[model samples]
Target: MPADADIRERLEAKAFELGFDQFGITEAATSEQIVAGFRKFVELKRYASMEWMAERIHQREHPQNLWPEAKSVIMLAVNYGPKDDPRLLLDKKDRANISVYARGKDYHDLVKKRLKAFARWIVPEFNCDLKVFVDTAPVPEKPLAAAAGLGWQGKHTNMVSPEFGSWVFLGAIYTDMELPADNPHRDQCGSCSACIAACPTDAFPQPYELDAARCISYLTIEHKGPIPEEFRKPMGNRIYGCDDCLAACPWNKFAQASSEAAFHARVELNAPELGDLVGLDDKSFREVFSGSPIKRIGRDRFVRNVLYAIGNSANKAYLPQVRTLLADDAEEVVDAAQWALEELS
Candidate 1:
């Protein structure tokens, strides 16, 4: 018998101990369809300003390209489901509506820590070498997770678990030891177009493709400069990320609030006021978002998002803040401030 040929139980035991919600293993192979879909996503320039996707296209083309001698990939999911429908915040014109994923401590840091712990246990127990990844790498996590039977990629192009829905965060453990692969999860998105209608910017070109340039999440977090005028109005109060598509999915009805405290929404961040977020300076922003994924955008870009929400707020109360931000040093901030001021006028 092959040594450590079957350790799914032990693997899942440790993964659950490390706070992961779901676990599955799959051979390190990307199907031709998966490879082509990713290539098309890049070829059609749907990645928008995220040039890294194109740069590492081949790395994601196959798991072995990123790590030779890899036999299997362990996929894990962390449920970050919100306690309430995140869409509830959309009509709160005076408040900032951050995505469910970013309202807490950064999942990348937390998940990577758990993945590292899991790796430390497996390398010695199973006599294998492994590398851990939590969204930072060129790994096609959604497809891989689906392949591992964790979930299907919904219309929003996010992994949707029957167990946890679209609210799960995926992580990977690529190992030299081969493990039994799980049957791929079947697509259950079916005829549901709720996620499609939920997009404020019509970011989905079709049922399963995303045009990031039109996504509010892209406008708020990924795209660094002044947001294009067209997406700004539709962005509404989403000051950090957008959760509409995820929240709109009917599969989410089965999602429970995350058991991990690290994934819980911070008190102040749950529903911060746009008036407050717009006033964040570099120092304050860092202090506020120190452990949050939001810190990556820095004050200029974050405040720019806040200003757009402020403009969409239709409240002249923020007029003074907008006027002051017009004198900000960052060209983008100044541009957003001017736009906010005009909208308020």
Candidate 2:
């Protein structure tokens, strides 16, 4: 085998042994087509309150601009699919639906730890400088993954692996090694608009573009203030992150349940009762979330999410539970609780 072919084979083997679901490598280069489109998207203010999207436009599009010496990027994805349909909880108005991703351990810590190990192995064998990044960095993981032949970027703006569907968590390792690049995947979305039509808030302004401010995922997890009234009712029982777009993809029928034990959903988080979640105080909340990603949102944001779920519940029995939180301190939490009480009452 040629040197490039040999390196690719070894890298694939190493990635599998390290617990990654899939791996691909690509040369560090920019696509002006993608950049131009991204620029137009930003100018339209589709990113809404996500100022960070506009702040790093240059670095996000051009990988070399992020780290000058980086010659190649190895993109890795870990699958986190669950056993049953995530949409089932939507029917139970009294139950809150947590996104499948946050139902398990935080992918940041898990993916980063594995990427660091992969980096240590790569540098010793290839003698290259490297940096690893999960979602926290400025690196454009979805675009890079598509460039590496992992999968096409679906209309929903997330990486869709042919093997793992849309349930993969992406991570990247930028290195000085000039490894052979894989062929980029072609756009496979074609005429399908399942995800586009399924969005409750119509967060997608156009195909492949998302307005995060209107997205339930951003509202419940990232936004700090009261959720706009327009989105609050549509948010339904989704307490953190929304999966309707991802779940609507027809390709998801090929998605397999994740093999990693740590990524499996904890029973407590699976269709949790709104009243039960609203009653959790800080200490109890910490204990419940413990090693899960939900803890990072902290107690206040979490209760705020639960309050939204309570309002959506339309269950008058939950009124007392929602009322109890109104006088409790955090402004965001108290505000949401008060709104929920009125809605329920």
Candidate 3:
């Protein structure tokens, strides 16, 4: 017999047992509007240097392209809400403001572990084929989560759970099990534009669109080249990623800090000093961010980000560190060091 609504109830209970905070199910299909919006986003080159996005556009727009036999998608969310507002650290220009999500253990590792466990539990009972994914796949996780009733894509283009606000990490399990789908969540942003106004780089060209080229998170985390002159000052002390839009959501007022201990902020990364980070040679950088997502950017890119923050700090105490990195092997790091010196001058 195929899985039914009863299976969904059991699965949801099991998801909670496995440490997921929110759960929903949706058909293994993509929304046409989301597909169009994504196409337009790439067509206009809003994805910036994220060429991988263009590479997998077809698979991303239609999840079925990834696995033709999958009949349902189990969307799960883990709340990683901070105990305090993440925006507060921005004022301390000498402190590096890592994104709230990156401060904790990498969610990819945490969420994928749960996803694999859930897939294992379901496969034996239902005899259904399944595949688990975190962020590695070309999955349209946010849109799929919205389709599964986890939340609606907010104006900032991140899924905003009414319960968790904008602080959820999404993971997916694609399965052939024929489970009932939930009602899709409708956009509830109302008239609030707090998220848009809070962006330091004016990344939003419109209420629901993001020009990733100007987005601090993308620039810090994804872009490999020199910091654009226009955005360097606005980059502030954000060394890894930016959370200004997420922090400004009024819905977050009702959000609670994550119950999952794995999501709690690590002390060293919580509000690191820019001076401390600017001096990270490749060896020290690896040790400092061993298991964190920030490590993926490597020492050159990581220190490059730190140098920009150093320039923004106006602390001059960082001058010696900046001057030392001026001779670094990586051109990106050397370029950032030069920029920092000019900014300080």
Q: Superposing all C-alpha atoms, what RMSD in Å does each candidate have to the true structure?
A: 1.2, 1.5, 1.1
Give a tens-digit lDDT track for model 1, residues 220-268.
9999889999989999999988999999999988999988888889999
Instruction: Give each model a TM-score.
Output: 0.98, 0.97, 0.98
Off by over 4 Å in 2: none
Q: List, residue by residue over 1-345, the lDDT tens digit for candidate 3.
A: 644767888999999999999999999999789899989999999999999898889989987899998889999999999999988998999898999999988899999999988988998878889999998999999999999999999999998999988999999999887789999999999999999999999999999899999999999999987978899999888888899999899899779999887778899998987887888788998998988999899999998988988898888878888899888999999999999999997
How many clashes does the backbone of model 1 have? Answer: 0
TM-score for candidate 2, please give it. 0.97
In angstroms, give how far residue 208 of model 1 lies from its true place: 1.0
Q: Rate the local accuracy (lDDT) of all candidates.
A: 0.91, 0.88, 0.91
TM-score of 3: 0.98
Q: List the residue pairs that clash in candidate 3.
A: none
Worst 10 residues of 1 by lDDT: 1-10
**Candidate 2 lowest-lDDT run of ten:** 29-38
